[model samples]
Target: MPKTQCTDGVVGAILASWRYDISGISPEMRRDYEQHLAECARCSARQRFHRSLDGALAVLTSLSALFFLFALSVLKHIKPLEHMAFKILGLDIYDMYHMLISAGVAGLCFSLIALALVLMATPAPSYLSGIAVERARLIEARLPERIRSIRLR
Candidate 1:
């Protein structure tokens, strides 16, 4: 039963939402908003709005669960690392066939994730993706120190 500072019109609207009035509320002067809404259509719209806001908040809670389900769907297979690497990169590295797939697959997955993140963050011409790819490669090359420096910044 907090004191409402708004004009009577707004107070009536809040009362109208819950179908209540100012005469016999708690502590003799406070108003229950829900009780007021039940008595008024205008206030009922506000009530519905509050419900919708709650629904929107629930959506954010479910988003992380959806992401978890999607990732589980994508990478749950317990396959050999080499096979996983090739599958991830779509590479035909026959020479690396005998090597362990773990490192290559991980690298490919990391690159793909970085690409996805960069794509999402940097909105620009399509050429930017290619440039990012090249830049990521150059950073990995003889300029390792430069890459480390950039990372610090």
Candidate 2:
């Protein structure tokens, strides 16, 4: 597609304010912006880039949640050295393990809430699903002819 600067600066600014997503707007109100996007390459490209960014943020937050959960699980399996702090080092930090456990649990909860917010506030799910569908089609195209035929039936 040929790159074209926005024809109307005011309309471009308005669309930018909405992040180029007019799905929540009334049909009548969205018509002009839709037309602009169809005619203006810059706004459409910006929309795609923003949606991809939202999808990437959602994915990152979900991965962060998983990592925190994994950290908590690993911490649960580790046994702290008992009595060694008091006898060998003469330090009475008996609550160290408990503190670490508390921190891990807190981090896990925070990450999960972040992930939930990302999923709720962004268009990431649909974007990610579209990506998955495209990937699946590409993989299917790479399959052998005989395997592909067996699946088609």
Candidate 3:
């Protein structure tokens, strides 16, 4: 497929330097970039791709943290792991259990930090919230008139 180019090179360069994120810019400065994005299909697609990447990173980090936490919980409650450590591996149960617990805790901490960094450094929060708001509006529009009236009240 042929590649599309940005309609405005100067504004496109600026947006590219900022990874197409205008959320951190002042409203006055953002207006021009926003207009460029709206008018240029190439830039708009690039912006969407960058935001989707940010959102994917946030989700992956979150899931990593949750999985680590789940691992810790399983280690704490399950006796089979202890038995496996002792019988199958021929290792000291207490030492192996402590090591696994420590690893799980460390992984959970690392993933949480990664998630925090992603949320802080990217426009993922605003982008995701915008999506949620749009979805809410669509759902509300589809609601029965009686329910909508009651909600308004």
Candidate 4:
């Protein structure tokens, strides 16, 4: 019924409400939706769009996890520097250091959990892996002739 929806009638409305994703549904119950999706262009396109969105979310969460990990590593390396500076300034920096480390650790844990959830709740892992494979192929194609020939073996 919405202007953005290209599918006509009740099935379209249902699919739209579900964001065109029936991955959470049981196989038996999903058969109908699967059949409809196969027969319907608009719904199938919407399904692809939703899957891509899920994949992007997974990638973002994974990147966030990596960033948090990097922050923790940087903080670890700077701990001695911070201690020296604070000692010279005659300031109490232990509390601040502990707080920052705690925050970084918490952030890293939360992001990792989020990344895991995204990968588990959607088909993002497969989608992302497919993209990686394509990128690898592209890179390999650009390799020098000698290296390419050696790689083929």
Candidate 5:
């Protein structure tokens, strides 16, 4: 909240809090240390570490939730999927050509995206010109009227 660079005492406090929460102190002037952290820089770093950890944990939880939901949905549709593929199409249940196709498609997509990024960039002009575009334009503008007329013609 206070944008000013915090002191070392504050940093100690943040670290103390993390250590206390994880391992803990013998006697409870943990309160005093916490107060000191509120004033110091060391503790602020600890707070940032804690916040980053919490963020990562939250992300992990979200991803796991998504995975489980997808798995559940897949389970629900499994019978219909198998019947559609194996029964109707007469493909072997053990065959995994779909995986290869998906992998190929992913590779192609990544390559195409890379190619697009490469193509979208402005290529550096030839070094022999030895001048920037604006300077070149100015020089071209200052050329003889006869030369300009010839160019126009």
Candidate 6:
């Protein structure tokens, strides 16, 4: 497929330098870029791709943290892990357990830090929240009139 070009080269170049993220800009500054994005197919698609990438980073870091937490919980509660460490691996159970616990805790901390960085440095939070708001509006629009009236009250 042929590559699509931006309708306005100057604004598109500016947006590209910012990775098409206009969320950090003041409203007055954002208006022109927003308008360009709305009008330009290429830039709009690029913006969408960048936002989705940010959202994916946030989700992966979150899942990594959760998995690390789950690993720590399993190590703490599962007796078989202790047995495997002692009998199968021929390792000191207490030492092995502590080592595994330390690794899990470190991994959890690292992932949490990554998640915090992603949330702070990208437009993921606002983009995801906008998606949620859109979804909520769509769902609310579809609700029965009686339920909608009840919700309003």
Please provide TM-scores, in order, for all candidate models, with all chains considered together.
0.33, 0.79, 0.93, 0.66, 0.37, 0.92
> Which pairs of residues have clashing backbones in candidate 4?
none
Candidate 1 residue 29 Cα shift, in angstroms, is 7.4
Candidates' lDDT values, in order?
A: 0.50, 0.82, 0.91, 0.82, 0.52, 0.91
Tens-place lDDT digits, model 6, residues 25-112:
8999889888999999999999999999999999999999999999999987888544754797688777788999999999999999
**Comparing candidate 2 with candidate 5, which one achieves the higher lDDT?**
2
Count backbone clashes in candidate 5. 10
Which lDDT tens digits does candidate 1 get at residues 1-153?
Answer: 224333347777555544332323565445355444555555555445544444444444345445544544444453434566777887666544434344445555655565455434323223344456889887667566876789668
Clashing pairs in 6: none
Model 5 TM-score, all chains together: 0.37
- Candidate 4 shows a clash count of 0
Of 3 and 6, the candidate ranking higher by TM-score: 3
Provide the global lDDT of candidate 5 against the true structure: 0.52
Tens-digit lDDT string for candidate 4 (1-153): 223445456887888787787777899999988988888777888778887898889989888989989988988888654567778877658776778789999998999899889888777777778789999999999999999999899
RMSD of 1: 19.9
Count clashing residue pairs in model 3.
Answer: 0
RMSD of 2: 3.6
Models, CA RMSD each: 19.9, 3.6, 1.7, 4.4, 20.1, 1.8
For 1-153, candidate 5 gives per-residue lDDT tens digits of 336554664545555545423224545756666665566655555554554444444445445545555544554456644566667777665444455445545554555554444323312122113235668789889999999999887
Question: For this target, which candidate reaches the highest TM-score against the unseen true structure?
Answer: 3
Q: What is the RMSD, in Å, between candidate 4 and the native fold over all Cα?
A: 4.4
Which structure is stronger by lDDT: 1 or 2? 2
Could you give candidate 3's per-residue lDDT for residues 1-153 as a string of tens digits? 118988999999999999999999899998999999999999999999999999899999999999999999998889954475479768877778899999999999999999999999999999888889999999999999999999998
Model 1 regions lying over 4 Å from their true place: 1-8, 12-32, 78-153
Badly placed stretches (over 4 Å) of model 6 are: 80-82
Between prediction 4 and prediction 6, which has the larger TM-score? Answer: 6
TM-score between model 3 and native: 0.93
